[model samples]
Target: MDTWWLLAIPVIFGLGWIARGFDLKELLSESARLPRSYFNGLNFLLNEQPDRAIEAFIEVVKLDPETIELHFALGNLFRRRGEMERAIRLHRNLLERADLPVEFRDQALFALAQDYLRAGLLDRAESAFKSLADTPHADQAAGFLAEVYQLQSEWQLSIDALQRSGADTPAKSRTIAHLYCELAEAAIEHKDLKAARERLAQARAADAALLRIVQIEISIAAAEQAWARIVELADQTLAEHPEFAPQVVEAYIDAAQHVAFSAPGQRPLDTQLRSWFDASPNDALAAVIIKRLEAAGSMSAALEFARVALQRLPRLSQAHALLRLRAAMQGDGDEDLAHITQMMNGMLRSQKRHECRNCGFRAQRFFWQCPGCKQWDTLPYAASPVGP
Candidate 1:
């Protein structure tokens, strides 16, 4: 037998003794009948007949009103079955008894808090959990409080509660970064660029490996028309995480454009564009290079650049760029355009925009958190094939 059963034997005998002293002969007799009903309820539970088992346990509670164990079991069962109302009623009744032991009372309060939490009565749940803050249940209550704060989108409160409970392990730091990112996004929405920048700094401090924070910072700098800052951040990001080169190409182009426009005689845009393209052969980057070449009155050079890129990435976008350049010279032809468009459509059909590597969830747009599994920084950018 388990050591808990050995410990419980003395409590059972004491309850029987107390019942006899109170001249509660019926209660004393009912104590003797407990084993049979308790075993029957266990059998029913093992058989997966939860309704029948709960009925048996309910009868046992009625007969032996002082049996705290039976009440706890029934309350837990109701909660497991999604019967929050019944679980709350049973736990509340146990809490009301003046004669109940302190341990049992604490257990009842914990159970009642769970009931309120499941019912979405967060205020009542918080109050009930607060009462257990000094008890053995404190750690568990604090963890639940963190979860409640997360649901309410109160990231700071959630972080505080998690720290108090010591539940914020190393693996949770990535999640902390995401929370800071969310705050940064909110600040951006409110047009508070300074606060948004501060939050992004905090996010990077929390988890230096978080590439999304760098991306967001670059975007904010671009929005503020801080061309130098944008270029600096984009360069740092690419140097740190080169695999995100494709995604950062557009920002880099925009930053270069801003610089070129700001200082016309400093350095030609083509020089910087050619240098980056030589360093990284990204389709998006190649596209930007072609556009820049065309803008500089060099359509023939742009065609040559597109052809060189096509050798590496035979995607529809590159092919379309080539076709448009050719048509601009030789006049429009539906056959060539139609063929390239069909190939592009075919490539897109096999592509997934984003996928959550943690949970295998696929979606069209990027999500910092997975909606299916609620994990932070789990989604990965998926590459689609280009056609010519």
Candidate 2:
């Protein structure tokens, strides 16, 4: 019995050794199934060497096309690194796979759309985002589609895309209004006053308090040579939107100049400007009044107005206007003084710009949408150098 027990223990030990060997072999086979580059890529990723990691992962993906997650990770990495061609190609390849799941296919399409957008291929991007409609990415895709249309200046299409988004937020409303306003401006440029008016009406309906709506209305009125309407609109703007007084006053000055020459019987713009200034006393209004006075050879009146404006606003433009009026009134006929004034005036004109309140983007003229940040109604109408 003792001898039989020793032999049984040896047999059991041999069986245990064979089982351990099988386990080790299975583990090795599993590890061997993954390409060496996969481990290297993981190491590179851990070490923060993205370039090397990308290279190593590309090898793994090339060797194993069945790696679905690897393909997605690699495609995203390419896109984020601005390698659009590679990202587009890889995502396109994923999409071409008939075996790809519906969710993955949608994801790949979205990624490809983003690639085209970043690459400035708007037409291709438009198509890709449009296909994503009604998918899980529908809402995001709709917003991106609107952006695509906006970049293409397809204002109506952008409005449609926004409508499809079905978002009722104030930002969306403002964007839609800006689109209508853009269309109105385009109509104005083509001398289609009727279309312009219709578009502005739509803009107002979208957002009554949007200052750009009033500004565009003034523009349309000016285009029609409806100087009285311009004045009326400006008066309304100053009354309702005192914060936008500078912008409204600037437009008023332009219309007032036209009225001065074209329609003399109309109430004098100068008289109206003075009245407005008396009521508001802002530097923007005061500067215009001073310029009108200077134009009429009322040098003393201009200087007096400048003195009061400087005391109130103390803005650089007002000080420059005051300097010019003082020089003209003193009759200093000094050539150097005149040259210095011209130089200072030129410097001020160059420096004075409509800076975007959102992004600080400066432009010589006003823009409803900030060129830098693309935000609507961000540029404030500050006073500019009064005269040439």
Question: Where is model 1 more than 4 Å wrong at Cα?
Answer: 1-34, 40-67, 231-253, 256-364, 381-388
True-structure lDDT of candidate 2: 0.82
Per-residue lDDT of model 1, residues 1-388, tens digit only: 5588888999999998997788787777766766677778989999999999999898878877877887888999999999999999999999999998898889899999999988889889878888888998988888778667777789887666666775556656777777778888888888899999888888888787888887788778877888888777766666555556666777777777667444544445566556666666655567778887888789899889889877776766677677767766665556776566566657665665567888887775567778766677677643445333
How high is the lDDT of residue 267 in model 1?
Answer: 44
The lDDT of each candidate is: 0.77, 0.82
State TM-scores per candidate.
0.60, 0.71
Clashes of each: 4, 0
Q: What are the runs in model 2 whose C-alpha is more than 4 Å off? A: 1-90, 96-98, 223-225, 250-286, 332-336, 383-388
| Best candidate (score: TM-score) | 2
Model 2, span 1-388: residue lDDT tens: 3577877998999999999999999999989899999999999999989999999999999899999899889988998898999999999999999999999999999989998998889999999999999799998899889989988889999999998885689988889999999999999899998999899989888877788888888888888788778877887777655657667787787776665434544456677676666665666677678877877888888888888887766666677777787677667676676676778778776774687887878887777788887777788765433333
